[model samples]
Target: MILAVVGGKGGVGKSTVAFGVAAELDAVCVDADLGMADLPERRGPDLHDVLAGRAAAVEAVDESGPVDLLPCGRTLAGARASDPRALRAALSAVEAEYGRVVVDCPAGLGRDSGAALAAADACLLVTTAERAAVADALRTRELARALDAGLVGVVVDFAEETGPLRGRFGAPATALPESEAVRRATRHGLPVGEVAPESVVAERLEEVAALVQRSTRSV
Candidate 1:
């Protein structure tokens, strides 16, 4: 399964949610945000290299971290040289080898984000409780539908209340409340389950993961 974790804008804890879900699923998380890679970095050929034809997709995966990741190069030249069209094949290759894959998609409704959603079997929308963020997520949901990527679930990060979000996106929504433990885990490139397994945030993330898994199975 290839699942794309996406947000309508940046800084909505999209990468954190992607990493957490990947960890829970035991899948390889690809940093598809070529221009602004937010996941942990490693010394090896990355997604940019794979997209640019310098390395194979399976060879670019780095398993040294808490989550297996196909990190992206943090260079403007690399991002420019990489082809977004190649992402579909690259993600397929990873899925064939890894069994399951999670993509940390670039923010917005641009070509890069479209490429990720187009290649995914399904997607999980990540957003905050703010009105503007929710609005953007609604727009993203439409794009995902247009691209044929099924929307399995939604994750509301740092949510104060989830009452308004339910049934808004045509998918079940899970709220992750504000927590210092989650913040620290994200800062260190670790999942909340690994850093604070007993915390409320960790349990909520697990629930979110389970929700996604169940939704995918039914699809």
Candidate 2:
């Protein structure tokens, strides 16, 4: 299944959550954010090359990592040259090879982000505890529905419990408390599960991974 891990607001731990879930599921984490790409870097053709017709999707995959990643080029020119419409075919090739594909979507419900959602079988919305963040998540949830993507649920990052997020968007929620492990792992461009296997944040991410897997079976 292709699962899009999205956020309405930036700085909500969206990419980190995407990396963690992909690591737990042994899935390919595609950095779909062409402009603001945030996954670990690799020295090769990346998502930019794929979208720009310079490389095949499979050939761009970097396997030597805490997890497999279809890294995106961090260049304004590359992002401008990329065609959002090409993402569908690229993602299709990935889904063909990997049993599970997790897309680290860019913030907002823009054309690029929508393309990611449209290519997914299911989605996992990411947000923080702020009201504005939750509001953005609601918008993201609506976008997922409009695209007919199955939403696994919402994940409230940097929180101890579900708090007031339960049933907010008509979906189940899993809250991950603020952890130094998450900050540290992300700071070093590593998966939290690998860096802090025993931390509470890693445990919650594993639970979220299980939830994403269940989304596949339910469909």
Q: Give a tens-digit lDDT track for model 1, residues 1-219.
A: 899999999999998889888999899999999999999888899999999999999999998988999999999999999999999999999999998999999999999999999999999999998999999999999999999999999999898657889989998888888889978997887888899989887888888889778878744
Candidate 2, 1-219: lDDT as tens digits: 899999998999999999999999999999999999998999999999999999999999999887999999999999999999999899999889877799999999899999999998999999998999998989999999999887888889888888778978777899888888988998899999999999998988999998878768754
TM-score, one value per model: 0.97, 0.98
Per-candidate clashes come to: 0, 1
- TM value for model 2: 0.98
- Candidate 1 C-alpha error for residue 28, in Å: 0.5
What shift in Å separates residue 43 of candidate 1 from its native position after superposition?
Answer: 1.2
- Candidate 1's C-alpha lDDT? 0.92
